[model samples]
Target: MNYYSHNIGDYAQATTHLSLVEDAIYSRLLRRYYAEEEPIADNMTQICRWVGARTEEEKEATAQILTEYFQLHEGYWRNKRADAEIAAYHVKAETAKANGKRGGRPRKEAPFSEASYGGTAGNAGSSENPPETGSQANQEPGNKNQELKETSPSPPTRASGFDASTIDLPDWLDRDEWCSWIADRRARRKPVTQEAARRQLQQLAAYLAEGHQPGAVIANSIAGGYQGLYPPRVQARPGPSASRAQRLADWTDDLRDVLASDRHPREKFMGTIDATH
Candidate 1:
């Protein structure tokens, strides 16, 4: 899989005791695991190299994190959480494939009723605009309007005819964001089918259960241009004083800027701010 969900709160809480380097190593290992959709290989040297752990400290951190977080199963190191995610991904993929083979979502046929038969009979005349008759003729204007609405043909069985507005949204879901997401899909020429929407909501509910905000989860998919919903990516939290990792990253960017501008690199060491104060 090219992508996987990363819960920032969960990761931050779990890695609170880890040093910056160890945290970095852990992140790289997770990326590899998700991309490969399999357990990390049991070879320590190869795993260290794959995650770019060159120094002794980095290598040791790599080994320590792997031992503490992953369980050695048979010949590979496995993470229970990662395994469960991969399994769920496969199940959803297979379901979508099967749905496609059946020519999109199954049509929801409106149940036939005597009222529907009456409506059909009302329209049976050859006239282009059939005259209202029977009960329709004797009803008040408001009642006539109601009868007309009830008699309208149900939406066609085609996928395009699925009305998203009629969807029964959950109370926890934000209505505006949901409508925006639907609009985004339609603008991309990828209309959401009823079944697809139902499945996405089900998945969204699971993410919500994990303490993810509904808006953030939906926004993640919209930003990524993803047709299916996914948990939001992890974001670094800000602090009054930058962490060592943040400082190093800022320093790297400043170095590049200094080089490009032909200024003394020492003029700004940690960030764009002048260092000579």
Candidate 2:
């Protein structure tokens, strides 16, 4: 008789579960004794008792064949079950549609053409007023919006639809200064410097001397620390240097005065500033 002739379940009962480990051991036994010819089919109870005595390590070695066999067989049933589910869905959809047609409940109407404002549809332009039922885009934002449409103008031209690119951007958005301003704000950060560190210490001392509250001390210390640590790498040219003179006369006291008055002297900048100062 063929070895392993009994069903896999009988062989599996040899172990608690047909665990891969049990199958491995059984296969090994098959190969060793029945290599040349089929081995006699062992009883399930006897096989279970025999497998129970064997180490799990021995069983795992023969598990591959059993694992592959079950995987292939199991996958077939899984696919069948999935196919059954799809068929059920199709039947249910058909039944629902039939019931809807029979008017079991109020069904949602398919959009064809709706009357203007909040009223029902009729022939085109049958009513002088805009459609009250459905708006141009068929958008129903809210009850207030529906009511408003009922009271307002007829379907608007397609041009009235929202397209940001078609919109007129605010004057500030088109200006280079606006972009530069944002860039400056983003550029504001801590300064990496020794002098700034010293100033930070000095500010802390001043705050303590002034007997300021802990919060104020922390706030001022942070600000002073940044100012001391980060020195502006680009120094302002004294009185606009020479090149500036070519474009707008010499850097006279008048120009220097203007620059200083307007904060070109070094007041205008980004970062943590002493607003109180």
- Candidate 1 lDDT, tens digit per residue, 1-277? 9988788888889999999898888899988999999898899889989989999988999999999889998999988667656655664676577669878855665756544324455555544555677877666556756876887777675445776645666656778988888998898888888667767776766676566777897787788676777667564544667776787776676575456434667743344656699
Q: Over the stretch 43-75, how does candidate 2's per-residue lDDT look in tens digits?
A: 333443444535555544334333433223422
lDDT of 2 at 33: 36
Say which candidate scores most in lDDT.
1
Off by over 4 Å in 2: 1-187, 218-277
TM-score of each: 0.42, 0.14
